[model samples]
Target: MKPNPISVVTFDLDDTLWAVRPVLLKAEDIVFDWLEEFAPKLTDRFTAKSFMKWRWDIYANYPELAHQISQLRTITVQLALEESGYSTAEAKTLADQAFEIFIEARHQVLPFETAIPMLETLKQHYRLGVLTNGNADIFRLALGQYFEFSFTAEQLNASKPLPEPFLAAQAHAAVNASEIIHIGDSLEHDVIGALDAGLHAIWFNPDDKEISADVTAKYHVNFYQVQCLSDIPAVIDTINKSRLHSRVTSP
Candidate 1:
């Protein structure tokens, strides 16, 4: 019997496996409380909304740090502290401490009901990995047990909808593009990016968003869509059967 054509499966971390907004909001609140205690002067200077604006300004000024989430965030904290009158050395220390608090709280996510079961089944059949634009580490969460490897935009210095991240994942898996699949929630970053990079992509569109005809025409690649994580294994099986039939029927 022939082997399964699809051997590797990579996933996006944030919204694909679990809701990110609540976790991030909670993390921010925790960080704010910590800052209030440790750096009361900084909290006195800026509210969350204004601090975010400052961070965006920093991002605009240093485009090179755009993909480096951890660095960018640390720098944002350091600058905010300095602006609030801390000395440079003091700000740097506080920034690192603040980031540590934020990151720890960030990992307190509640996974979707189906995320683990879906990963459990998929891992038994294919090499599983992660490719995420966010800094959420799978190893920090329970889902870490399901993945063999992971790549992040911050680590690679490249974000998706650009081909480098996808290409890097394919290389790491030691598989041809056709033999790998990338599953994620974002159409532009995950679906279109993976398809453009010559890999099969499954859009984890739980929101039931419509993929317009113009998107297909613009990308010139077709992709699979699934509303439920549980449907993924069946989609991969369908992809394998279709590839097998194509091989047998092709000239």
Candidate 2:
């Protein structure tokens, strides 16, 4: 039996394509230093620990702001200033200036060595698209040409583990859910969300942690797992083969 041809392959950016945490940490440091220099009042509210905590607090407080990481950082800086007794207008200006410094210094990304080459290879065989929940301007990162379309939580107004964003990617890819495969690093958001949206999913588990029993059940129902980006092409090939076999077996 021949394998099923996978028409569309969608990916989550951030951790899936690159080592996001280190880049983000460095970016945050750059931002913090800028705040100290130009927005000293705002900087007073954020020690490294408090700044990290504030990020989650802000996310919880403004769920709609999840996809706008950059904007959220600005707002966080502004709010931190206000909390520390600055006037709203003062906070806004300081935060905006600090954020500009952060943005200019934040262009460095640590994409895995295999990521771009893998994309180059995969693009030849399948339609590629991005379904990230991040504010990383993928186009600015020079990855835009590899993808036929890209969707974000901001664009769809829905974040993963929700079906809306996944469906949005499907729409952008112009393919049915079953014909597309979604890949990403988060087991909860990427794997479960894509599965729920009726697409096959691949868990990009670079950390080698075992999926919990609870997650295993979810994974077994609709997804496969891969330890590295390098494994993706083989996984796609296997899926295509299985698809072909099933079709041949059908009446």
Candidate 3:
């Protein structure tokens, strides 16, 4: 039970740090506008609702590509264009261009008031990183400086709430599970994923909703729950201190 010194801190993007729903809604609107002007054949054939359904169908058919949302979206756009009578070459060019615009708008995010400040503070002590299932480009938003590295489900072909990406992060950081802590908003995705991979977890439940992810009693001690950004450091400190004391007192 020796105190495991923390070396790396990993986080979730999207709702954990910013309001992603608005960002995505605006991003979708921007993409829709771009498509109407630049790829009208595709737009004329399908409204936004059906366009979204086509995107969903892409994932449903080829789930092995689940983590690669960017690619899936690009493929969906290309299919829409081709189905609307664009030639193969034209469809490919339009899809790639449209996807570029979509992603550029996607990273345009507004962080929570304390989110960046807390990251700045943590960067002073730990090697911070991001692990996200979404196609968010932190580097595109000038937030890259805060993270030492990022693990995207897009690159791994595996998403979180599953242990592949989390274990991959553990290997990349070259630290034991005890030496790392993951913070994110989803009870199932961040907390359960981290614990399943043998790391400590801090649930960033900002809404303070009742815990519903089914925590069996034995695993409770490995969890830390936080409602506000400023509270994270203290909770992490408490875990470290508890581990140190356990080491000291063990027979």
Can you write out model 2's per-residue Cα lDDT over 93-182, one digit (the tens) per residue? 888987777766565776888898889989999998888887766777777789888888877777888898888877777767888899
lDDT of each: 0.90, 0.81, 0.85
Task: Looking at model 3, report the run of 10 residues with the lowest lDDT sum.
Answer: 211-220
Cα error, candidate 1, residue 150 (Å):
0.4
**Rank by lDDT, descending?**
1, 3, 2
**Which segments of candidate 2 are over 4 A away from where they belong?**
1-4, 44-46, 64-68
lDDT of 3 by residue, 6-122 (tens): 778899999988889998878888988999999898889989889888777767886767788889888878888999989999999999998888888888898988888888888
Q: Which whole-number lDDT from 0 to 100 does residue 64 have in model 1?
A: 90
Higher lDDT: candidate 2 or 3? 3
TM-scores vs. true structure, each candidate: 0.95, 0.89, 0.94
In model 2, which range of ten residues has the least summed lDDT? 1-10
lDDT of 1: 0.90
Positional deviation of residue 68's Cα in model 1 after best superposition, in angstroms: 0.3
1-251, model 1: which lDDT tens digit per residue?
44349999999989999999999988988988899899999889989778777877778877898799899999988999999999999999999999999999999989989998999999899999999999989998778999999999988899997888888888898888888899999999999999989888999999989777889687635788999999999999998998899778777
User: Which candidate leads in lDDT?
Assistant: 1
Q: For model 3, what is the error of residue 4's alpha carbon versus the real structure, in angstroms, after optimal superposition? A: 1.5
**Which is superior by lDDT, 1 or 3?**
1
